[model samples]
Target: MTPRKGERPPVPEPLPAPVVDAHTHLDACGAKDAADVSTMLDRAESAGVDRVITVADDLASARWAAEASTWDSRVFAAVAIHPTRTAEFTDADKAEIERLAQQPRVVAVGETGLDYYWDYSPPAAQHEAFRWHIDLAKRVGKPLMIHDRDAHADILKVLTEEGAPETVVFHCFSGDLEFAKACVERGFVLSFAGPVTFRNAAPLREAAAFTPADQLLVETDAPFLTPHPFRGRPNEPYCAAYTLRDLAALRGDDVAELASAVSGTADRVFRLRTVTSDLPNGEGLR
Candidate 1:
């Protein structure tokens, strides 16, 4: 039977089932309202993205991300001051972040690290703020999510000197093969993002191939860095399939197996065990 003229069209068939988006920013994305949030989650859920770790780079966004986590079992929160915004970091801000980190839904302590590309904040300040975040992660016994952009040496030095939490994740890892080897040797997880799917990102693809099985993860870094075939458009958590496919190709591994492995890595690093039942689909929650 034909549908009514005012009736809504059926949703598209969902992507492959049981995919996990290791990193994203649900609150900062298009989900500014309850309806928008629900729609976004529905899109992701329909795409087989069972879970996402929504990250916030500032206090206000952190609160929003935390609240979003409460609104949906599929969402989790990662809070910290982005390196570019280090000027806004203060003791009180740290306190608030620490408090949020103690919350049941908060997973990791970053999206924080050095960003020499913009240099929005002084390098020294970025380093100082990064150290403080590392300390906070240690104090709370949570993993650290690092963001390194054109500051690989400095990042390595800081992590080696100040010492990172037991679990350190280098999100959107774009480093060279040597850096990838070093990170693997140090037992740090390297999370590949949309850039890895670019044709010109051969170096990143090489790094992706070098990441050890247990130390590899995948993310969308959404609303930005949309993977190939979808570049130049706003990214979303549901687009993580591109990254997973690229990583699997680079490593010559089965896509399904790699996807499941990275999901497990994310689960362990983010302490998803404590919040599995609260997660959607009963997959990769712990």
Candidate 2:
């Protein structure tokens, strides 16, 4: 239909492209309403972020993420009780988590681990909850997405003692280079986030530089830790491009190539079967 006088023209359609965002909190990013989620996904799609794994750290958010996924093709959900929120977990929580793990759209078992920096929950409770989540991951035969903040040693010790699922990912990895090496050695995938693009994040950048291509992944961790150019702004999936650029620079590879590599790693770790591209290693991104 032709527009009337003084009417603005319609926006051109965005080019269809494939990109994967390894981590983000869909429910925590003001997407609590259906309209908000639709708008958020629309922006993501316009920016070429084809798929995103929405991580929920508690039962309420988990249910929200799962329900949101059912409404958006590009959204998938990961449910777990975050370390900080572990104090809220009860026996009912455990049962609910087990039942949620069986859902088709729910792919991984966390955003769960130890966070010493913010002792929102007691250390002992965090430890117990962390182990329980790990056990749940093993029982469900799914990958685990872990969050470690200033508790790398404890996290490593727990993973070693209790053993992680076959597919374990250190999401938004902020550890030192030594820990990065340790994680790779332990067969854990390290998912870098916007922090890697920060000027003072030398340790994170160093870890990014040395991580094996196959063991590396990328995420946005949106609504927090937005990359340099957008550091103080509200982060979203599109900002992952800056992270991709930084990672490619760190590895001295093409941006598209690095994106392909991390996308493949994410697909494998998340058990996604319909990714949009293939890795340089000749493996399907899925």
Candidate 2's C-alpha runs over 4 A off are: 1-17, 274-286
**Candidate 1 C-alpha error for residue 50, in Å:** 0.9
CA shift at 112, candidate 2, in angstroms? Answer: 0.7
Give the candidate number with the greatest lDDT.
1
Q: Any residue pairs clashing in model 1, and if so which?
A: none
Per-residue lDDT of candidate 1, residues 170-267 (tens digit): 99898989989988999999988899989998888888887887888888888788887667677788788767776777789887788778878877
Give the Å shift of residue 159 in candidate 2: 0.9
Q: Taking the tens digit of each residue's C-alpha lDDT, what string does model 2 give over 1-286?
A: 6445333122223323355788999776778766777787777777656788998888888888767766665777888999999876799999988888777668889889999889689999999999999999999988899999999999989988998789999999998899999999999999988889888989889999999888988788987777775566677876676778777887798777777777777778887774222124423212
Cα displacement (angstroms), candidate 2, residue 152, comes to: 0.6
lDDT at 60, model 1: 91
Question: Residue 125 CA error for candidate 1 (Å)?
Answer: 0.9
In order, candidate lDDTs are 0.81, 0.80
